[model samples]
Target: MTDVLLGIDQNVDRAVTQAETMLDLFDATDLDANLLHDFVDNPEGASVKQVDSVKRARDILEDAGAAVTLREGSGDPAQSILDMAEQLDVDLICIAGRKRSPAGKALFGSVSQSVILNAERPVLTCGSPGDEA
Candidate 1:
């Protein structure tokens, strides 16, 4: 019974796309909580968006026969992802990557980069469709 932590941000469509490509990796999944962490200051709006995002991912994964339980968290995206993965002790971490220019990444550090650098477990990253990798 492998536990997979599917890390997602506000890009619900991109997350769905990544899930479609990686769900087969986890043999047996009974997601206790579909963790949705908001990395924004405004709690109210962020919570609403987080719920919607989690529900979308939940629906997509559930349709594919994955049992999902929705959960919520707060703070930095990368930190939240790492914290959840560690607390849950997940077997694998799947995260969706957005194509950002080097300048942009320098200006605003990459979340995936942070997780990949700091995570103790394996991190699988999927870029958006048509992305140059």
Candidate 2:
């Protein structure tokens, strides 16, 4: 099975939805998918809502036949994503990218941009309508 890794950010549900949609689109083909939801889950600094959401995302992905795993990082979402891709030796990666303004890009380096620039495999990016900047 060709492994497709969905690199989920702090907001994981959206990534899962997009990846599933892609899977459904290619339903006729043979492909295997999994989701890796990463975050900084410091025992003293994490929010209950965040933890629960990540867990729920994992459960949903697993139910959909993709292995789901939650990994802890030091708040570097991009690094966490790359680490997971390397560990899995994934053939493809799907990540959520919001439309960013020039200002936004200057202020906060775009994670999607970083991934697209660094990924060894193909990276699929989805953006919100308003985020189309």
Winning candidate number (lDDT):
1
For all candidates in order, the CA lDDT equals 0.70, 0.64
Model 1, poorest ten-residue lDDT window? 27-36
Per-residue CA lDDT of model 1 for 41-124, tens digit only, reads 664555534455566777777777776655455668788888888988887787888888999899998888998999999988
TM-score of each: 0.82, 0.71
- On TM-score, the leading prediction is 1
- The residue pairs that clash in candidate 2, if any, are 99-131
* lDDT per residue (tens digit) for residues 16-114 in model 2: 465555556544145565555555556576642365445655565566566444555556677777777888898877788876688999998887888
The true-versus-predicted C-alpha distance at residue 114 of model 1, in Å, is 0.1
Candidate 2: segments with Cα more than 4 A from true spot: 25-32, 40-53, 128-133
Question: RMSD in Å for candidate 2, one decimal?
Answer: 3.7
